[model samples]
Target: MARTKVALVGIGKIALDQHVPAIAASPDWELAATVSRKGTVAGVSAYTDFASFLAERPDVPVVSLCLPPVPRFDYAEAALKAGRHAMLEKPPGATLAEVHTLQALARDRGLTLYATWHSRMAHAVAPAKAWLADRAIRKVHITWREDVRKWHPGQDWVFEPGGMGVFDPGINALSILTEILPDPVHLTRARLEFPANRQTPIAAQLTFSGNVTADFDWRQEGPQTWDIDVDTDAGRLALRMGGNVLEIDGQPMAGENTIMGEYPALYARMAQLVRAGESEVDLSPMVHVADALTLGERVTTVAFDF
Candidate 1:
């Protein structure tokens, strides 16, 4: 099989830390070019604009869009129209309607489109899903807290309208929940706390049906935490370190590191889609975020600095 030539847009933190390394390690993909106004990866052709990158490398059949959700649809539409397969970073678009539009465009063009949920590829997630398949779930609790200053220092876009401050990380927890749960659950109640200076929330408390509840806070002073605990009739299940490790009844279970596993799995899935001439479009995760915004009650909190 010929290697798929790919270009990356929006050389942000995630693109540099995760995607770049993942692509370099994947045998099926070659990082052909990059588009970013501020940063450049070593040894890769870098362009200040997407137009120049596309113009110079028209033969690159795949484009991975790593930009924030606000301006995603336009670029995704252009990529599909140009007959290139597209890989969209999570929270696919700012609005659910735009995501639907992208899906339609991909189908019309017969191009492969991937809306990736990197968290769903977590190591312990699949095993937990399999273990709880036959048991009746009683309750679920999620706690995801991190220091914005430490993780996203100087990332101003997170507070902008359509930036999805806390939801940026909270969406990962939701994605994992949606994948692990056996039954469908919808948001019943939600309270969002936004820093007085920002358009998006800094903390969110959400309740879901099937007796499931989630608490997501993106502002922690020190020592980050990401954990999910579930109580079932059979036993107790707990996932720590963002689902990279699992514990059952206070005992550790073997697990894989999804940070290293996600991109390779993503490339494999993309290859399969391109080979079959199909597009994989699932917006349930993003739909929940939009629904939360439309239906959730907003509260003002202390203004955030940095």
Candidate 2:
């Protein structure tokens, strides 16, 4: 089988930390080129602009946009219009509307477009999802708190308008929840805490349909925590380590307890979809964020320093 040439755009931390390694390790895909203004990966073709990248890799069939959501839509659209399969990072686009637009373009061109949630590909997620697929659920709770300074460092775009602030990490939780839950969730009420000096929220308390609730904060100072719990008729299901560990009824369930393969799994799935000429366009996760931002009440909070 010929390796699918994948052009990675936006050579940011994530593209270097996760996507580049994943692409290099995958046998079904190869790094054909990269798009970034001021960064480059050794042994990979680097283009300072998207135009040059596209021009050089005219035969490359896949382009992964690992950029921020604010500017992702344009790159993804450009790739789709160029008749290339477009792979989007989590939180698909700046708005829910943009994802739909890219999907339509991909459909019209008979190309595959993947909106991947790296968290959903965590090892424990699929098993937990399968376990809850037939069970009756009572309620769901999520507690995702982390120190943004440690995770994001001096990334100021996180606090800018449309940058998604805490929801950037919070959306990973939403993606895992949406993928595991059997029922649909809708935002009923929310309280977003915004820094006085920033345009985006720093914390959020969201209430969703069917008693689904979440508490997201970017102020934790200790060990970062990512956990979700489900009260079901059969037993209790708890996912810790951001869906990398599972416990049932207060007992640790035995299974693969690793999340390092998330990006690798995402790339493999995207390759499969592209080969099949299908699309993996999931919008339910992003919808929750958009809904919360659109309908939630706002509260001012202290300014955070990185």
Candidate 3:
């Protein structure tokens, strides 16, 4: 079977760290080209502008966009308009309306548009979901804390408007939560802590329906934390290390203990969606983030640098 050609649009940290390696390992995709002003992969065709890439590389039937939320919609819209299948990174777009528009455009053009939630692809997430399928009413608590300096380094765009600040990482927790829980949940209230100099929050406390609550912080300096605990009639269930580890009643369960499996699974799913001529656009996680921004109480914190 021939691998489908794919053009990766953003060659920044994530594209280089995850997307490139995943594509290289996949049996279903070829990294035919990359479009970025300053980032490029060895031996792959590179284009600084998206328009030229679209014009010259019509053979690339699929485009995977890893650009930041703010500018991602334009590129996605252009790719769908050009009659190519498109895949998007987490949080899909800065606004829900734009993603909806892209969905409609993709449907009209008969192209696949996948708004991916990579965290939902973690190794333990499926098992966790299965465990909770027949369980009764319960509660969920998420603690997602990390040092932004360690993860994002000096990327100033993270604190800018549409960058999503803490919600950028927080949404991963929501993605996994939305996937595992048998019942739906919605944001009820939130408190967002913004750095004095930044346009977005540095930390957030969110309350959701079904007794679900989350504490997200980007200021931790030592060991990072990505954990979610669920209490049910069956027992207590927990997902640690960003849904890669699963636990039941404090005893370790069998599952992958690292975050390495997510991207590869995502690429595989994208290939399946393209082959089936289907589009997968789940915005439930992004809906929670949007609700937080719309209804969260604001608190000013110390100015953040880097």
- Winner by TM-score: 3
Whichever of 1 and 3 has more lDDT, that candidate is 3
Q: How many pairs collide in each candidate, listed in order?
A: 0, 0, 0
Q: CA lDDT, every prediction?
A: 0.86, 0.91, 0.94
Name the candidate that leads on lDDT: 3
Q: List the residue pairs that clash in candidate 1.
A: none
lDDT sort, best first: 3, 2, 1
How would you encode candidate 2's per-residue C-alpha lDDT over 1-306 as one tens digit per residue? 779899999998999899998998999999989899887899988898997777767889899998888998889988888888999998889998888899899999999999999999887898899999999989999999999988888999999978999999999999999999998879999999999999999999999998899999999998888999999999999999899888999888844666678999999999889879999888888889889999999999887778
Q: lDDT per residue, candidate 3, 1-306, as tens digits?
A: 999999999999999989999999999999999999999999999999999999999999999999999999999999999999999998899999999999999999999999999899888899999999999858889999999998888889889999999999999999999999998988999999999999999999999989999999999989899999999998999999999999999988957888888999999999999989999999999999999999999999999897
Ranked by TM-score from best down, the candidates are: 3, 2, 1
Error of 1 at 150 (Å): 2.0
Number of the candidate with higher lDDT, 2 or 3: 3
